[model samples]
Target chain A: GAGVSQSPSNKVTEKGKDVELRCDPISGHTALYWYRQSLGQGLEFLIYFQGNSAPDKSGLPSDRFSAERTGGSVSTLTIQRTQQEDSAVYLCASSILTGEGAFFGQGTRLTVV
Target chain B: AQSVAQPEDQVNVAEGNPLTVKCTYSVSGNPYLFWYVQYPNRGLQFLLKYITGDNLVKGSYGFEAEFNKSQTSFHLKKPSALVSDSALYFCAVSKGPGYSSASKIIFGSGTRLSIRP
Candidate 1:
């Protein structure tokens, strides 16, 4: 892909349902990140992946939120038992290296009603 | 611990006037600073970064940033503001150089820049 790509640009899920967001990063990008942005809020870091391994998961808000990256390319963010507060734009970014500027995806607007 | 702070929630500037968005960071080691812009209904776009040298780093859309080591600040500046330049700006910081495993970039609370025509 020319840039980072995310699936299901918008999602409306019922409360307590599980939602899965997907991210396909640019080819050859080794570093990937996941962030959540609530309405009128800043980006909240969720996780970071170096290759297929995630060394930084300290930003995950709770046990309900989990993510995994496979083959160092595509990644998935799963939110279980979603709540109303979980309604936000989930963003995914990938960079060529750890310290480089990351290219972001269009983001998935997840709305839990 | 690497963190970034953008003090102002918003900044208003007249079109064609110079504009500035403040940012400060805290990091254990050498810092890699970055500026990103987010237009309405769009994802973030990278502007500039300060990794090694030349504190005055220029990036897309005539944007530049000064990396002040002593103050731990990387402020985004533009000589002339455009209506199209109005957007949400984020300042981010990572620990070290490229390829460092510990360089997890942390972003600040974004500052909304409004350029009035």
Candidate 2:
């Protein structure tokens, strides 16, 4: 792909439902990341995955949130029992490698009704 | 843990005038600071970064930033502002080792910069 791509640009889910956001990082990128931006808030780091390494999940807001990257190419972020506070723009980014400038996707606007 | 703080939520500047957006950071290791601009309904675009060496670094759109280690600040500046420059600006810091090898970047709340003509 020419750039990072995210699926389901917008999602509206019930408060108790589970939602999965996906990211396809730029080809050859060794690093992928997920962040969330709540209304009027900043980009909150959620998770980071580097080639074949353990992902850093310290930034995940709660245990309800989890992510997995397979084949070092694509990733999926899952949020269980979504709450109203979960309404936010989920952003995905990929860098040539960690510590380099990262390119971002347009983002998926997740709204929990 | 590395974090960035964009002090002002909004900054207003007049066209052809100089503009500045303040940023401060806290990092455990070497600080890697960055600036990004987000246009309306668009994704963030990279502006510049400070990895090592020089205190002054220049970036896209005729913008520049000064890294002051003494102050732990990396302020974005432009000699002349343009209405097109109006956008949401963010400052970010890279989390060093002991965290993710991927070097996760922590972003600030963002400052809405409005350059009026």
Q: Ten-residue segment with the worst summed lDDT in candidate 2 chain A? A: A94-103
Count: clashes, candidate 2 = 0
DockQ of each: 0.76, 0.72
lDDT of 1 at B3: 88
lDDT of 1: 0.91
For this target, which candidate reaches the highest TM-score against the unseen true structure? 1
- In order, candidate lDDTs are 0.91, 0.91
Docking tier of model 2: it is: medium
List, residue by residue over A1-113, the lDDT tens digit for candidate 1. 99999988999999999999999999998988999999867888999998745459999999999998877779999999999999999999999875678899999999999
Candidate 2, after superposition: displacement of residue A92 in Å? 0.4
lDDT of 1 by residue, B7-112 (tens): 9999999999999999999988788889999999888999999988898999999999999999999999999999999899999988776434655679999999
List candidate 1 segments past 4 Å from native. B98-100
TM-score of each: 0.97, 0.95
Query: lDDT tens digits, residues B13-74, model 2?
Result: 99999999999999886777889999988898999988777889999999999999889899
Candidate 1 residue-wise lDDT at B51: 86
Candidate 1 C-alpha error for residue A45, in Å: 0.4
